[model samples]
Target: MALIHCPSCAKRISDKAPFCPHCQFARTDDPESLERAARIRQIKHNQSLMTHSFIALFAFVGGFALWWWGGEAADGWRAPAGIGLMSAGFVGYLITRVRIVLAKRSKG
Candidate 1:
């Protein structure tokens, strides 16, 4: 049998499979169902991206606050720790934003 993609989860499966092993979706000839499943998966992925971006923003802001709270001095642990957090958060936020844009662009 040839390999086919599961309509529900988009995983590879045997064409002769009676049901999708990954998602337990029964084999069907309905195009609408496949479209609906794809939309749902995309929505979930977008939500996850948003959540990650929010967390990154929170980290960045918290780092900035910590840096200022420590009197903006370079001779303390707070300075280095805050800088590290800020860098990580900034990078993470940028990556997430790019992924969001790409995901939106890929909508079919």
Candidate 2:
């Protein structure tokens, strides 16, 4: 039998199989069920992306607060450390947002 991708888990499986071995999703001729599974998966992925973005935003804010602490010129290590954290958080947040948009636009 030819190998096909499972609708639920996207794993390679035999086309003749009735269920996915990986995720145990039953394969059927019904388009509605397949579409439902795909939709659920997409929703879950979007939620995860949102969580990542939130964490990144929190980090960015925290870094800014740390850098701005006391208002006076940041002395030795704190300035550099805060700047580094801010850069990392900004990049992470941007990438996550891009991924979220792409995921939403994708059909499957």
Best by TM-score: 1
The digit string of per-residue lDDT tens for model 1 on 31-66 reads 987788778778888999999999999999877887
Q: Model 1 — TM-score against the truth?
A: 0.81
TM-score of 2: 0.80
| Candidate 2 Cα outliers beyond 4 Å, as residue runs | 70-73
Residue-level lDDT of model 2, residues 1-108, one tens digit each, is 899988887889999998998999999979999998888777777889999999999889878887988987566888987888888899999999999889867854
CA lDDT, every model vs. true structure: 0.86, 0.87
lDDT: worst 10-residue window of model 2: 99-108
Worst 10 residues of 1 by lDDT: 66-75
How many clashes (backbone N, Cα, C below 3 Å) per candidate?
A: 0, 0
